[model samples]
Target: MLWTLRSPSVRHLQPCLARKLSFTPNSRLPRITKDAVREIPPSTSFREQVARSAAPKSFTSEIKTPPVRNQVIVFLVGSFAVYSIAAEQCNVETAKWTKKLSGSSLIWKVREPTSEELRKAKRLELGRKLQAGLSSLKDMTEGWSQTMRGLAVWSYIQVFQPILDAGDGKRTCWAIGGVNTLVWAAWQVPKFQPFMMKHFAHNPLSGISYTLLTSMFSHRSFLHLLFNCMALASFGKSSGVAASVHLMKEQAKNPHGIQETDVTWHFLAFYMSAGLFSGMTSHVMTSKVLYPRMIARLTSKAKPVDAAAVAKTSETITETSEKTILPSLGASGAIYAAVTLTALAFPHTEIALMIPPSFPIPIQWGVGGIVALDVIGALRGWRFFDHWAHLGGAAFGAWYYNYGPHMWNSVRATHLEASQKVQRPEKTD
Candidate 1:
């Protein structure tokens, strides 16, 4: 009777078996079927084959084994590619409500508004005013024509056109435009003024948590919005290019491999959190040091100035929260974060300032100079801008550049492993 051994090491025991045993029909062994006792194939390493087949096929394996450098590259590259794609896909119409679920859908999607027959929208004066204008067919047609004309004018005036490859989806321009449009509208609309003041501007003492997010998009000044958008467009686009190059190189190695949305989430998380922390930094500095000093100075020097005026100033400062509460309203903090990140990601890239058109500076040097200026500004009590916020944002960008990718990968791996465990139960021997 013939028998087959399923062990991969069985081949190693062949000599021992040959010397000790002789197979005979009289031997009391169960016969192995011809199909089960097939001859070993020639020119094959059974051990290697078995090892490859039994290897873990989990995504965690893919993530956990990569070098630290590669992990960063993968994350940064993946994020850049996704950002390019996501930005290109989103438009003004969809951007208002199109949601991106951080790690899963790096892409933006508008949710279908649920039809609730039970509840009706409250009709306020503004809603009635908006509806009143659209009642007449002639007025509607005129409004439509005016809107088309305005769009044409906007298209003509747009400084940054769709120069990106169509495949990438020219979405960044829209985001920049949308932000600028909102800032412009806020200045023009009386009703929007209070909304902008409450939500768009960050006040540390306000106790509203969401101001951190909204403040990043709010700029009360036209110049502030214009300059920030310009910087974001230039540096952000350059950073995206660097990331894309890195991604393409990786894709070249494993053409069939799938990528995650980790990069997109990383960039976005880094951006938003940087803004929040930066704003908090400013708040800390002001509340702990700057505000206290101001109060002390006002109390101590009250006699030097016009006594009545000083008294009035001191009373005004004491009575109203506005004087004590410094409201920061701008995208400077977030833009600074992007600038520092871009400098780190592509240090050799040349940066040119609009003021000095003839001179070009290394990105790293430029970032260093900007950081130094912020430090000086912060120390000297320069209140022209939120220097503390700038420092905070820059610090975050540098830190994130160094360690963010590895941390991100580790988190993703942990999440994936947990999910795999939930979906697949281990078998018992």
Candidate 2:
């Protein structure tokens, strides 16, 4: 009895046969010659056929791709609006605190505190808070093992103490770094891996908005967290009001103004904006451009088996799996923004590479080199890092370095005026 390709007896062999016959599901079926039909052994059992055709399952199939939507404009507009509102609130609160501490409403109108005065006040307040925290920790750890106590103290000094001592910019960086560390720790649990990947990692195909922000604080590896945190700290410190004045020696030209009362909100706003922009950039490039190109190549006509062909095919599949299917997570994009901004703001500053232990090089050169590498990686389709995101962040940093200060000043002035109006007594008729 002859066995047709679609016969029940050979139904299990269709995929294998189709692959062997060089025909895809959507392609026209080629005529099977007598010789080709006889190549299948008549005695081959259905079980054996099924076994031969089966390949190892991949995690790709388990991940569901959500419907694509263009969210670039919406995300940018919404995020910036939120940032503006938060900045206004922070400015008002800072004004209130200044009034309370000085015991004089005249300070706001007569003479605002200088940056030096603000810095001293900030440091004193932080010192008191740090002392209180340390005392509490000492009491709590008194009963613990000596080793544990020593470790706890060491960790506190190494982490929290420095964060408190540093300027508000660096303090904010450490706070973000702390969150990243927690996320990294969570990823180490075997059972938590799946959940973390789904929630913490940003998948372009996932069509989720929250992950774009969440992934900024999600570092999968200790080294990644360490490097990014280190970079953030360096840039944050360099960009601080005090540090910039010291480095530039031109406080008169500083666009951030002399009122260094509280820039925590401003820095936080910039960081979040950079992260969202970078994440969106990666998402659009993958979902709108690279992803479609990948699918087309994957479904196109089969090529002959050769070394180059096999290698290219493997690379394509791997890229698709890593970028499109598997999610991307880390703080590199936001850090890149900081790095570029610092480089441009303080062009005379020197920086040394942490990984290679390079001698101090001008920051401009260092940032330029880093950005060039990213450009090359993006153009060459390097799969190790999300180069598009890095580039996006760098672009935002440069752009903001020029215009962000003016925009922030405008927002603060508007809010301050409104706040004063509210506080003013209404005229009696």
Model 2: which ten-residue window has the lowest total lDDT?
241-250
Candidate 1 achieves a global lDDT of 0.56
Give candidate 1 misplaced runs (Cα > 4 Å).
1-177, 238-258, 261-263, 301-314, 319-325, 425-429
- Against the reference, the lDDT scores of all candidates come to 0.56, 0.74
| Residue 177 lDDT, candidate 2, scale 0-100 | 83
The local lDDT score (0 to 100) that residue 280 gets in candidate 1 is 67
The sequence of per-residue lDDT tens digits that candidate 1 reaches over residues 1-429 is 999878768889888878845466555777888876577555659887787786555321222211223223333454455444433322211222222222224232243321110001111323455445434433445556777856654553353233322111123434654776677677678888887888777775565555656777777777777787777666545234333223223322332222332123334545556666677667667666776665565455444457688567756756554564577877677678777877877778887789447588788898899899999999988878899999988987777667655544444445545555777978999
Which residue pairs collide in model 1, if any?
87-171, 88-169, 88-171
Worst lDDT 10-window in candidate 1? 114-123
